[model samples]
Target chain A: MLDSKQMITIKGTKDGLTLFIDDHSSFEAILDELSDKLSEYKPKKDEPVVPVTVKLGDRYLNDRQKKQLNELISAKNCFTIHAFDSNVVHRDEALTWKEESEIRVVNRIVRSGQVLEYVGDLLLVGDVNPGGKVITTGNIFIMGNLLGIAHAGVNGDRDAVIAASYMKPNQLRIADYISRAPDYDSEGVYMECGLIDKEQDKIVIDRLQVLSRKRKDISGFERRMLNG
Target chain B: MGEAIVITSGKGGVGKTTTTANIGTALALMEKKVCLIDTDIGLRNLDVIMGLENRIIYDIVDVIEQRCKLKQALIKDKRFDYLSLLPAAQTSDKAAVTKDGMETIVSELKQEYDYIIIDCPAGIEQGFQNAVTGADKAIVITTPEKSSVRDADRIVGLLENESIDPPKLVINRIRNHMMKNGDMLDIDDIIQILSIDLIGIVVDDDEVIKASNNGEPIALQGNSKASIAYRNIARRMLGETVPLQSLEDEKGMFYKVKKFFGMRT
Candidate 1:
């Protein structure tokens, strides 16, 4: 007799919008609330935000609930919905609802014969075993082992990356590129993956060295990591 | 309290029913109250194996659909008072019972017996789902052959997704002499690949075929190599830690010399 409650919270970012849902709330109620808030931000002539961002709660959402959430977001023009469990991955990016999409999945173990698909970036704080698969339209990050299949940018975003703590997946795919484990024994940094270079039209993978980028003003989870 | 264990193999013709018949009879002969439920609806054989088919007036579907009471459907064993058979209905389909329905029946049977063993149907369909629905534990049976092992792996995957914890493996129809001569896979290979807890190892015994023809389970006779293996499985289900009988002892120097002379073991 354990039922979950769904709560939806909306906050305006400097660029666009941010919608957040806390753990295990009524999904139907959250959708109704989201529809009401979305109508309020239709488009003011003064607004300059590109695409909106919505953050989802970290918990098990059944297939029906997930499909319903996806349909609701897609109805809005150029909007992105991010889902994550706070208990799993602690996000740190700072922006008004106008920026990056976030999605978090906190499962104990992704069992065999179960196919888990997400439209945005996925952060898994659990293991993906032999028969299970994680398919995402954006980047995928696994805090635990990736022993099964992990496909990122499933919709053909070549820049998407698949990172995990223990990357021993049976198969790895990003965008349209695919890679299986090499026949020879090999090991490098903990996070290893298959990625594509658009300019070269070639797929290559090695150790994930830290990328250099301009540091942006950070707050919340990102700010905590920057300081630490 | 008897454990409700389901013997499931995702592939057909891999000896699940045979294993169930032997294990149930073995447990009964050990003085444990046992009821074997054939959940294969439309193709029930537990009654035939137990030689109670002629006496079967009521079946599991009758009891479940409320056409009859539980006691009326139970076929008492002639060999042992502790054993009974709940045969599946040959006319009904898998949809005749749901997972919840099976759970109710198992929970009720659990109160009256020391062990309730379910014989699951092949494939990952509704029948398989119903069989494991109310099981407290599961024993995935497989032969060392490739096709059987592949199906076993698939079943293991399904069980994990369903969150059935720590399922035990029972390797059946193993041929030790064939393994020594590089003709068959050894026990170590199967154990390493499946990566699950082992309960028993049943050897290929001619006595099993002989007993089946007579409509008597080898476990009741308690002399064939397969019967001892089934006894080990029953003990393991009872939470007894009994190591498998050494295959090496069974395949001693005499069998080795027979192999040297190019004789078929």
Candidate 2:
């Protein structure tokens, strides 16, 4: 048994229009009705007709069908198409967006076979365990232990810095230059490594002087001891 | 609840499928509810390895497409009482399942099973993405060869991006003799470069090939070297602190005698 009295609704959106077909109605008849409507409404030379969605009861068109419709609409070169399973709001901006700030992974432990890489600044909040690697096109900051390999300035930025809390990496690199950590253990010495001279530098076990914010209440002798 | 663990390597013929089959069967033998999801799609082989090819009436695509429920597509393992398989679709391509689809399927399966092992397809593409979408952890399989290790490194990189923590490594088809003679890179070399915890090491065994050909994983065979390695891995995955077996233990008496004579073993 077929129902010819069933109604189908078609509406236009920013990108295209949605076509709603009753589940009991014939798909071919619905297409005929749409064509008849298009013939009567004949769009302008620049304006195009696109089918963004086709809903038949609860079973909407699948991705394959949506892509097919998108292709057909693009062939006409009039309007864009965006399809979904349910009602979708029209958006003026492009659906895809590129973020300015790169992805950051903090305090992350990269275990064996685990890699942490990003296109922007990659700040590790924890250790890059042995068997773990961190690669980045920008600067790499490891706030904790860095016993793993790390490659910074992957895009040939020589100014990129590879800083770590412990500053002991099995392998470390900045731009094209590579350096290995001191295999032999050292005593409680804080180190910060970066380019100080014209060439790439690795300052292992070298402490950076911290500028003390002194108070006026401190005496000269006490201030000398504190500053020293 | 079952945790989806994808055994992946970016390179081909690096023993990804072999590792998946062994780990899946080993976990099942340990009385844990397990399911092996073959995300290879058109190149499905987990079914063949598990010997459930003849039992597959519904493929994963059918379930994802809503032609059938998830249960109707699962093929129970004949060897293990608690094991089941969710075979990938052969007729359809890898595009049949999205990352969201995989996440949804794994979430549903996690409630019923103890371990969900995904046999990922080789290469870092859509198939790889689909396999790892819902993985709570990852097991990367690689051989002793340099190229295999390189690809495994990239796979490790991929798992890290997916926010999957503590990816385990299984060095497959290792030849201890070559390693001892310094002709090949040892475990220490790989550990130094890759910097991950070693879960297990499988020696080069003829039994694995024979068992795979017969559609049976060597893990089901007791007393075999590969089976022991698989069991050790299962133990480690269960939070057991099992030490890696020494390579000297695998050497025969004749080799040890030769070593005593300052000769190459």
Interface RMSD of every predicted model, in angstroms: 3.5, 5.1
Q: Pick the candidate with the highest lDDT.
A: 1
Give lDDT for model 1: 0.76
TM-score for each prediction? Answer: 0.64, 0.57
lDDT of 2 by residue, B1-265 (tens): 7687888878988788888888888888889999889999899988888788899999999989999999999998887678999999999977889988899999999999999999999998999999989999998888887678777876776676786876888898888889888777788877654667789999988999899989898899987788888988998999989888655555678888999999975
Candidate 2 wrongly placed segments (more than 4 Å): A1-228, B249-265
Candidate 1 per-residue C-alpha lDDT over B1-111 given as tens digits, one digit per residue, 9 for 90 to 100 = 667889998989878988999899888877989999999999988788888889989888898899999889888998878999999999986688888778888988999
Residue B224 of candidate 1: its Cα lDDT? 70
DockQ comparisons of all candidates to the true complex: 0.15, 0.07
lDDT of model 2 at position A103: 38
Of the candidates shown, which would achieve the greatest DockQ relative to the real structure?
1
Minimum summed lDDT over a 10-residue window in model 2 chain A is located at A92-101
First chain TM-score in every candidate? Answer: 0.46, 0.42
lDDT of 1 by residue, A1-228 (tens): 122443666677775566677666666667777777567767656543244454654655555876777677757554655442333332323332112345556655565566778766688887776656899876778877776789987877666777787777778898888877778755533775556656667555555553222112212244333332
Location of the lowest summed lDDT over 10 successive residues in candidate 1 chain B:
B185-194
